[model samples]
Each structure stands twice: as structure tokens, then as C-alpha cells.
Target: MALQRVLAVDDEPFNLEIIEEILEDLDFELRTAASGPECLDMLEEFNPQVILLDVSMPKMNGYEVCRAIKSNPDTSHIVVMFVSARGSVEERMEGYSVGAEDYIVKPFGQGELTAKLLKLGHMLLEKDILEQQVEDATTTAFSAMATSSEMGQIVNYIENIANIDDVTTLAKALINCMSNFGLSCNIEFRINDEQFHHATSGMCSPIVLELFEILKSKGRLHEFTSRILVNFDYISVLVLNMPEGDSEKHGRIRDHICFIVSVTEQQLLAILTRNELCQQQQNLNGAIAMISSKFKGLMLLLDNNRKQNEAVFKGLQEQFEQRIPTMGLDEDQELFIYNKVDNAIQKSVAREEALIQVRAAFSEIESDLTALSNKVDEK
Candidate 1:
């Protein structure tokens, strides 16, 4: 478990030789492959716990090779680190998405490569120790709980979590589900931009929480000794004990744990999305209400203006008729002035009609907005 074996795969013979030369002093079981296919072929026989994969190999690139290795149940546990000239963020993310544990750029010094490997070596040793502890600590209860069928538990878990709207409730549901499988575990969930960590017996210890933070980006599934760390998006789960003595049960449990964590992550996302939508709906409702109120005020003001305009037109006609005879104006002059007053009154009537049309349009707009808000509420 001290990182005994390492396989370096590259298209360039010189690059492979350089890797070998750099690690020669570290006493590793070093091997080299000239192509990606050769590297895969060596996996079954050499079975190195770590792979130094070059990104730009011909035929099958390093990303593809890493994906293949991680997808295979037999070799999925092998850690992959990319050794490549492409050091961009996009390239590194691609490497991780395909199950590479770490990324190292080309022309790395001996000290850097060795130091990273040494850290991995420590991790392997810790994993071995954890495995032994799990085997030693496993009880009769766990063996009895391992009936090899987790479908029912999964079904119930999904049912229980489907309608969960709060992170605390969801966290408790997960802890209880794992307990049903006889697992003492710690779980971390990132919900609504908040982080919540829960454990079987109590809150997650400081060290366990730190481990979750460190291991969350390691991959979808990472095992150390007797524990497996499952991660997806904003969810991370650490199963405290795995049945080490029973390989068949262990494999089944590992798969089940992965599936369960994936479902939990999905549920957490659903909760977050649902909350966001609800907030948006509320905002829409508020906007509609405000617009409707403004429209109502405009209609009232228009109604008052229409009544005032009619009163003014009536007073002008009455005043003109009464003053014409008193002023002893010529008949032609009186008739001309009367015609001008009538034309002005007609224009005011037209404006009143336009205001009525404007009021109708405002009512229609308000109705449409109200209906849209109702639709959002239904969902």
C-alpha cells in the first residue's frame, strides 16, 4: 500500500524514459507504455494503483483511456493523474470529469512529481489502514444487513425524498437510509448556498468535514481503506465502514452507495431549483399587482378629466350665448364666433373618446398580466 507500482503512458519514447528516470530514485515499480492501447493492456497484468497518463496519445487519447479505466468495474479503483502539455483549466476539468484524480503539466521537476506521488503513497497507506479497521470492526449486524438486495431500500429512499423541500429533512432522510443498511456514515449537503454536514451518531466531526471538503472533487467515487467517498455536484457522503472480508457484498454495497449518492444529489438540486422558481413566481405576482394598481389609478384620473372637460365645454357655450345679445354684436360676427366655439367643443369630445379607448386597453393589459400570474401559481 506504499504506492509500489506506477504506469506511465505516453506517445513519446523520450517522455516515458524521462518519467522513469525521475522516479527511479524513489524505488517504485515503474513501467512504461508507448501507446494508450498498450497502457490499457498493461492494466490487467501490472495492476498499478496509479496511472501517469499523457493527454495527447494517438488513436486513444488520455481522456478516453482514463474514462475506459474508470468505467470498468475491475479497474475503476486505480487512481489516474494526467501528465500533459495542455495545462488549461478546460483540459484539467475534462481530465477530472473522466475520473482522473490529479493533473500535472509537462516539464515538471523531479521534486514536484515525487512529492505528489508521495502524497498519494500516504493516501494509499491510509486507505489500507482504514480497510483493516473496517474489517476488524464489522459486526454481526452488518453481515446480517447485507442480504445483497438494496433495491427495496433504494425505492423507499427515493419515495421518502421525492417531496422533501428542506435540506435538514433531506439530510436526516439520508442518514436514516444509510443506517438501514447498517452503515455509520457522515454526509455533507450544499443547499441554497449553505453547507450542512450530518452524521449517524451526531454532527460530523471537524476532521470528517475536512475530509469531505478535500475529497468532494476527487471523483464521483473514491475509496480509502474501508470507507468510500461518494460525490456529485453539491452532495458528498462518507460511508464509515465497508465489509472488507466479503468481496461480493463489498462490490454490491459500493455500487449501491454510488447510486444512492447520485440520487441524493439530484434531489438536492431539485429542491434548490424548486425554491428558486417559487421566488420568481412571487416576484412575478408582485409586479403584476403593482402594474394593475397603476392602471387603476390612471383610469380614475382619466374619468375625472373627462367629467371636468364636459363641464368646461357646457359653461363656454352657455356664457357665449348669454353674452352675444348683451354686447350688441353684428349678426355675422356672432355667428362666426359661435361656429368657432362649436368646433372647439367637438375636438374635446374626440379626446374624451380616445381616453375611453386608452382605458379599455389598460384593462386588457391588466387582465393579461393577472392571468399569467395565475398560471405561474398553478405550477
Candidate 2:
């Protein structure tokens, strides 16, 4: 370690000698100044860590010198200890008020002087270490906050884009999200053999595009150069211009990108599936409507045929009653003819009941089809 620099300023030559002797055994580079003016002159080049100041001087006293040192930005950090013959409590308080770290009485023991200097040196070292730790902690906290903010934005954007049913619009939204983080990105989505692509600029390099395909097959996150590529089931996102030399920040960005891509892929797939199901439902509804129309036509034809058969049977019954009575048949023959006519009418009634049952069954079928069509429409 480098030696700690110490400047001892005392107007008395004998006092300076005594201070030099007291601190000689310590690991310090000592510079002595006979007056406050001389000390101020040496401070620029000496840049001592500690200043041993004497209060009683001819023109410029140690109190004035201490205040001057404290006021100057360049020399304010140096520790100033008052070494004076004036040892009263009032003198000590005055010394402290003037920015002195400690006040030592004149005729002090070698042990006391050495102990005070060593303690101040240790304090200075601890102060430096503590300041460094605080600085480092502050830096880490800011970094974490920044990463968290970026991730939050990514999640919110994914949610918003999920509501968009169009693949092209979703692709554009993804691009905008990446742009918000100051990243250049190229995205591609392959849904049902349809290709959709969006890029930050006009076009991405061929190498990057090829890598997007390769990474998509891998279905994971990959990093190369200043770019990171994340892949999902049917989508690939290429994030470019990532920061270098900061491993922590890079990892944060990579994780965020992967999560965003994964969620977006799921949403896109759901939209595509829903669209396909809707189309199939439409086709099914059309087929059902056509069958219903055909059944309705068949029902009309059956009604017409039933009415014509009834009219023919009635005519036959009228012909039997009129013609048989005119031929002078016996009573038994007339009764047998009436029985045959009644049997013909009963057979016609049975056929008409069977046709009505068939028509009722067709009507139930049509109701079921209509209900199914309604259910599909609701979906």
C-alpha cells in the first residue's frame, strides 16, 4: 500500500521537530510547513490525507488555516487535528468549531500523539470503503429497477396485443413493444402456412433472418454478438443492438424477450384456432339449412299425395253405392259391399296416420338442426 501523506504545520521550529519525531515511526510521508502561508502553498502538491495544525502562530493562526482548508473544495477532505499549548475546554471547542478533527495539548506524550494519528488514519480508510460500498449499492438498485420496469412494459404489451385477432397487427404491436425499450427487432409469425413479418427498419440482414428460422426450430433463447433471438411455437423474435459488457443487464433483457414471445405465440395460436372453428361452424350451418329446406319440400309433396289418394278413395266409394243399388243386388250382397267400402276407408285412414307420424319425425329433426345452428352461432 502507498504511504499516507501527513502535513504538520507549526510556526515554531521546535514544535515542528517534536511532531516529526512523534510520527516518524509510523508509515506516513510527513511534510512540514513553518507557517499557514507555507502550508497552503504545499497543500496543492502534497495533497496530504491528514493535517497536524498548531493554533498559536504569528500572523495566521491554526484556526484561520483550518477554516481556509475546509472552505476550499480541493483541500477540504484532509483531516485537520489541532496541536497547541492552549489546552482549555474553550480552546478545544474553538478548535472543533474551526473544523479540526481532534485537539491535542502541547507537551503530549509520544504514545498519545501516535495513537491519535493512527486512529484518524484508520477512520479515513473506513470512510473511503463505506463510501465505495454505498455507491456500488446505489448502482445495483438502479439497475434492478430499470430491468423490472422494462419487464413490466413487456408483459403489459403482450396483454394488449393478445386482444388483436389479426396476425399482422399483432406483429406490428410486438415491434412497437421492442422499440419502446430502444431495441431493434425483426419478428415472423407462421400460422396455417401464412407468413407475417415485421422489422424495425425496412429489412433485416439475411443472416439474421436465417438465424430466426434456425432459432425457431430450436424453440429456445439464443444469444450471439449484440443480438438475442427468442422462439415460440409459431413465432420468432430477433432482438438486436443489445448492450455488451453488462452480463446482468443482458440476462434481464433476454429473459424478458423470451417471456414476451412465448405469451404472444399462445395468443396468436388461440386466435387462429378460433377463426378456423368459426369457418367450420359456418359450413356446418349451411349444410344443415340445405337439408332443412329439402325436408320441407319433401313434406309438401307427401301432403299433396295424401290429399289425392283420399279424393280417389272417396270417388270409388260413391261409385260402388250408386252402381250396385241400380243393379238390384240382394240385401246380403249390399251388406258385403258396405263392409268392403268401410274396409277401404279404414286402410286409407291408417295410411294417412303413418304419413302424419313421418312428417312429425321430420319436424323434430328440423327443430334439432335449428337448435344446433343456434348453438354454433352463439359460439
Query: Which regions of candidate 1 deviate over 4 angstroms?
Result: 1-149
Q: Which window of 10 residues has the lowest lDDT sum in candidate 1?
A: 140-149
Best by TM-score: 2
Candidate 1, after superposition: displacement of residue 322 in Å?
1.8
Candidate achieving the largest lDDT:
1
| CA lDDT scores, all candidates in order | 0.89, 0.86
lDDT of 2 by residue, 245-287 (tens): 9888777777777777777888888788878889989898889
Tell me the deviation in Å of residue 299 in model 2: 1.7
lDDT per residue for candidate 1 within 1-379, as digits (tens), equals 7899999999999998889889988878999998889999999999998999999988999999999999999999898999999899999899999999999998999999999999888888998999888886685456556543577889989998998999789989999989888899999887656678889988889899888888878778888899988888888889999878878789988888888888988898888888888999999988988988888998899889889989998998999989998998898999999999999999999988999899889988988998888888787
RMSD values, in order shown = 25.1, 3.3
Cα lDDT for residue 90, candidate 2: 94
Q: TM-scores, in order shown?
A: 0.60, 0.84
- Stretches of candidate 2 above 4 Å error? 1-3, 11-14, 33-46, 56-61, 72-75, 158-162, 202-207, 318-345, 373-379
